[model samples]
Target chain A: MNERILELFEETPETYVSGAEISRRLGVSRTAIWKHIEELRAEGYTFEAASRKGYRLISKPAKWQVSKLLNGMKTKALGQKVHIYDEVDSTQTIAHKLVASGAPEGTIVLAERQTAGRGRMGRSWHSPSGKGIWLSLILTPRIPVYFMPQLTLLSAVALCRAIQKVCQVDIGIKWPNDLLIHGKKVSGILLESSGEDERLKYVIAGVGISVNLLEEDYPEELRSIATSLAIESGGKVSREELVQAFLLEFEEMYALYMEKGFAPIRLLWEALSVTLKRPIRTSTPSGFIEGIADSLDDTGALTVITPNGERVKIYSGDIELK
Target chain B: MNERILELFEETPETYVSGAEISRRLGVSRTAIWKHIEELRAEGYTFEAASRKGYRLISKPAKWQVSKLLNGMKTKALGQKVHIYDEVDSTQTIAHKLVASGAPEGTIVLAERQTAGRGRMGRSWHSPSGKGIWLSLILTPRIPVYFMPQLTLLSAVALCRAIQKVCQVDIGIKWPNDLLIHGKKVSGILLESSGEDERLKYVIAGVGISVNLLEEDYPEELRSIATSLAIESGGKVSREELVQAFLLEFEEMYALYMEKGFAPIRLLWEALSVTLKRPIRTSTPSGFIEGIADSLDDTGALTVITPNGERVKIYSGDIELK
Candidate 1:
């Protein structure tokens, strides 16, 4: 009944829909219609009521509405089944639990806000309420566990493309996981996996993007190095639209990766990367190495040529451009 | 109290210990000693009773006794905490449950029999009752997930060295996991892991060794290919001694690996491997490839030179010697 009432309101979006008309259209009493309106108002839907003009929907809630998001979704696999949350500790945590219970590939968990969002290397991600796109996508790829880094790079490319297309802002990848705009971090991708033997059982690609966040959303420490699309583009962006675009782009890129291997995705990642082909110092698990960023190897490791004219492949590290 | 009784019996292995003397030494009544002996009998221990001679220890039960196994054990970490069972679906299953409940590294799970033992590629392993060593050792290695195959090779080398030392027989590893004697299978090693991101959480190295099985213990299909240590050595090997030797050798090898790297373990594995430098046909995940088995790469992958003069790294596969 609420959906029907919403549909009637949507038909005449600019004008008020009378309670008697809504009751007649949905075959309910005017009292039921008024009660439904009260319930919708409690859920953050704003209604403009008048003595004779009836109720008009002034605005919808900032919280994610599953029906609204899926109304015109374009992806085949990704985001086909989504679990939306008003708030969560982290989308990745829920994704892990869902995977343990046999969640299918492309299952997505989204949250309007994260109380304890996580970044790479155990850093805390800033996810304000209803201001960004915070999600975890579950993928069960038929590949060896070593090839997991490729998926991380692939996700970066997909997100970069989606943000550019949806928000009309330039975004560049900063090696392994970060997305930057004008040399400021705008997004972070963290890829985690669970498997047995050499085969991968599932991967949780957790992405946190600062889409419509204002300048005050970040902490003082992050204000100097962090940014959001709204702050960069001089206008707020729609989180729902950005999420849909990301899912579509990610689904296409994932299909291409599964079919043609990581060659194309590597090329895309290199093109969008702001860290390659530069003099850099990397702090790897073993130690620090100063070298020129070379290229990505077959296993998605970053190859760096050191000053001694020797090439080294780095698996996991933090890089600083010199 | 049971451990004390066992220690007293060990003091006079070949002679009888009077019940009255045992009661006096332990400060227990004669009735209590009788009840303890009955309980020991129920646990499969055999006792020879004589009215005048008191009691003689005929033989201990074939079931694994934790106290006996831990007595004089020569390992630092491995087998320090052991869970012994008379029957289980598989030791690997129990090890996984233990890991879920925060079981520490070097925890060991042992079973006298596995009704549903598993091998690589979902094959069923033949684990008979009280005739072989079926165990799973839990390891929490601080290494990248890609280096997991090295642990598998390390385990094979450790098991090979231990078996050779304990049973006084020549045992060779076949490429990745199988242990063979006289070109027949005697043991198999299966390594499994669970982790997130690039770090490994834990690895369960499930090893099944046919220790004292006779020819009739194997089914007709496996009789021609499977051989036990007893069948090869013409004597029953002590299960307790073999388990202890394996745990000690594995702990030493694991420490060396964590200290140095896979280079040393690789050399030991190569020395014991019978699969290198031979013409072989490998059925990998991609397909079958006819090649000559070459050296192992740094990641512990078996490299094979194909007919087209291409060196291909075989990650997971079954090999047939040509």
Candidate 2:
């Protein structure tokens, strides 16, 4: 009933609905309508009540509003089943638990804040309360486990397209994980999987996008290196709209990749990449290698040409532009 | 105290120890020792007692004897922390649970019977009570996920070597997983892993070996397709000795793999393979392909020369000799 009322308010954002009309349409008493309004108010929804105008929705809470998120969702599988949290240790941890308990593909876990957010290679991600999109998407791709790195690249392209659509900012993807705006990190993706020898059981693609966070939200060490969409756009970005856009974009790209292959996704990733054709240094498990960032191989590995004219394929590494 | 008693009896299989000697060595009363012996007898251990010679171990239960298994375990890590079950759904399932709860690498879960054992690609495995070695070994190898298939090959080689050393029967590895004796499968390997995009978190290598199972032990449908070490060797094979040998051999091979990479393990696997240089038909996800098995690529993928003279890499498939 509350969701229905919220949907009614969302349908017309600038108008007032009379209590008598709401009661008649909803087949409820005036007192019941008033009680629901009070409940909404308690949940941080603001309304303006006047003797003649009845009630008008003024503003929604800064926290996630599921009704608003689901209002204009266009994705088929992605975000169809959503689990929202106010605060969590990490959305990825919750998603792992959900996947273990047989959560279907495209089931999403979102949090308003993460006390222990993580990035690729077990690094920390800064996620302030109600200021970023911290989410983990459960995916069960039928592709072989060797092709899993392509999914990370696919996610980066999806997020870049979604951010471009939502915030109108030109975002570039750093090889493997980070999404950047003017060389400052705006988002990061961490992809984890559990599976058999050849096929994957499920993958938890954890994406943390800084949306509404200000400069002060980042820690002192991360202030210069990290950025948010609102900071880059010079305005407060709507987290709900960004999430909806991302889901739609990711769903479309995922379907494309599943139908076509990594070729299309590789093209999109290369177009949005800030790491290609540059001198870079990578700290890989095999040790450090300094080379020119060349191109992606078929399995999504970055092929780098060393000073000695040797071509090396880097599977996973911490790369920095030189 | 029971394990100590078992160790004392195992020290001199041909001799017997009086109750007075056991009481003195274990610092327990004769009544306490007698109570423990009653407990052991209730657990299917047979004893022979004489007027002067107190007790001799006549036979142990067909079930796994954890005390005997640990008595001469030579490996440093493998099977160091063992969990034994008389019956389980699957050792792989229990191993997954254990890994999720922070069980260390090389921890093992063994069961006398699996009510719902699984093979590769969701196939069912027949595991009757006390007739086979059904176990799952938890491994935390510091390797990329792509190299996980090599672990399966390495396990097959280890099982082949172990079975040869213990049972002295010639065993051959069928391309990806199966261990065959005279063209019939004697064992199968199923390797499952949980990990990040590039690095593996842990691997559960489940091994099922038909050790002491006779012709009547298999189901009607499986009798023609499966053989046991006992059936091949015309005698009852010691399940404990075979398991110990496997643990030792696998531990050594796993260490070698971690240190020297997959080249040596690949050579060993190829030497034991019955699939190479044979006309074969493989049912892969891409569809059916008939070819002659050529060799293993560097990453352990099976390379096959098709009838059209195209060399295709088979990452995973069900193959049969054409």
Candidate 3:
């Protein structure tokens, strides 16, 4: 397998391994081993080969390589098929295009930096090169499209866990998909879908995290609202490590979601929610309503207790924390 | 005002009145009449003016001409601004692009036919030239994006009312956005949105109607599952008349939605629902449940009484009519 070939090259650095040895180790033909080595070389691996010295792995790019990203991903399908874009306008837009073209479930779109990054409520997210994790994950969940709200909540929990494990900082979820540190936004999530009445073809979760940007890197307007991991952690954090942690956490939560339903996730989300049990003003199309946040129902709708004590379930909207 | 200018042209079809006469009739100066006539000419209208001869309405395209389409449409902001596309891949895609570019509310995209028409669940709809209505309406409703289900239901009611008034044939809303006549699909609606937590920037509702397609016009494979107005009424239907009727009905329903709430529309929808009080198979991502359709809850979820007599609320999924 090419995975084994990669492992062999990783094990021996600057030392050539013979084709016969690789074929013996992996029980494949010399031609096959040479073919795999050629493929690895095409994927930015510098392999030196000779009749006596088999293959020597020279160098690997410091960038986020697809092979390295998927090397440790633990899932049946999530993130297995990925598209790496050097630059893109919006990952969410690309994900929708992929879904329309019958891209497999769990196909991910990762960009070095988005030329036109978007945030919650059509706001622009500043995604500088190599500063944050700007990626969109495509999910083809068998769940009804209406239950899509849970995906955002689940993502918040996963992100929180990732940050806590990596930096050991106490972060909180701001109602929907905002990640807050001392009441400032460090990350945001946007969930989108395309489906019909009964069947959902795909859902794209566009995640933008302010991982390593300095205070100067942020726009002058967002200086007060946006914070990054380096600013909070006081040191540069490894983006690969954070992405790995986030992916692992997401897979775990997604599995639990399928097994136990949104009740357990709702419980976890409520524990981390900064808006639950707080008074908030939600502006709907017709008018605005001030209500206290109750709890999430089984379907992932946020139930709000109005001034009259009537519980009006808010399905999807922006909540202004009072 | 162009509205007054159009009125004069309508009242006197054979003669072109001088700018002075039009100004006197509309109580405006000659310059204002000239400006209004220029605007009308820009909208594909031809004007011939001599010393006494007025403007004549020469020709109007029967399919989705902006002037003719908005002639009878009523709304504060919806459908007031029209964009007619002679051919497009999909109107929804174009609408999304327009929304990103700051297109205003009530902007409409009407196409004579789609080169690659799309339907719900990633299916293709047959859009024969000049035989169907392929249109999308861009709305920036001030509602939580999750309550979009209610909008779909509202549009369904509007569509059914239009059909009833135009064709004198009974049509029913099939649980979601499908318009069914005698258990076959006649029209479908696909609603997509672009927004973030609680605030939707824009929502595009792509509607497909099999207007004047004959039985042979339909692909042989779709003959069993799809029907057209010609097949249903045994006579050719007017595309302009149907479009006008739909816009009027939709505007009225949208107004009622703003005045009252979704309760009244839900009541009307329940009355026309063929799935209610019937044994059916409801399939969700979790599993499949065979049950009797009881009613729809406030959040637009279908309450199904499972075979075990347990009421399970299905927020989204496919339902099979038994």
Reference-based lDDT, each prediction: 0.84, 0.86, 0.76
Error of 3 at B207 (Å): 2.5
lDDT (10s digit) by residue, model 1, range A1-322: 7878888999989798887788788999989999998766544465778878899886665777677688768998888889999888999999999998988998999998788999887788887777778999999887766677788789999999999998888889887868999989999998887655666768899999987666645556899899999899999787788889999999999989988999999999999988898898987657799999999888778899999999998777567878
lDDT of 2 by residue, A1-322 (tens): 9998888888889799989888888898989989998877644466777887788886665788899998878888899999999879999999998987989998999997788998877778877667789999999987777777888889889999999998899899988868999999999988889878667878999999988766545556898898889889999898889999988999999999988899999999999999999999988766899999999998888999999989998887678998
- The TM-score of the first chain in every model comes to 0.80, 0.80, 0.76
Candidate 2 vs candidate 3: the DockQ winner is 2
DockQ values per model: 0.30, 0.44, 0.19
Residue A246 of model 2: what lDDT? 89
Q: In lDDT terms, how accurate is model 2? A: 0.86
Residue-wise C-alpha lDDT for candidate 3, range B1-322, written one tens digit per residue: 8877787777866666667677787899877777876665444354565656555565332355556567766556767777878778888878877887888877878787677888876678777556678878877777655566788888888888898899988688888778989889999988776544334446788889997766655556898989987689888787667777887788788878867878988998898888899898976755798889899898788899987789998877557889
The number of clashing residue pairs in model 1 is 0
Q: Judging by lDDT against the true structure, name the best candidate.
A: 2
For model 1, how does the per-residue alpha-carbon lDDT over B1-322 read when each residue is reduced to its tens digit?
7778878998989689999899989999989899998766544455677897788776565777677789957998889999999989999999999998999998999998788998886788988777789999999886767777788889999999999998889889987879999889999988877755556768899999998777655657998899999899989788889999999999899889988999999999989989999899977556789888999998888899998999998876568877
Question: Which pairs of residues collide in candidate 2?
Answer: none
**Better-scoring candidate (DockQ), 1 or 2:** 2
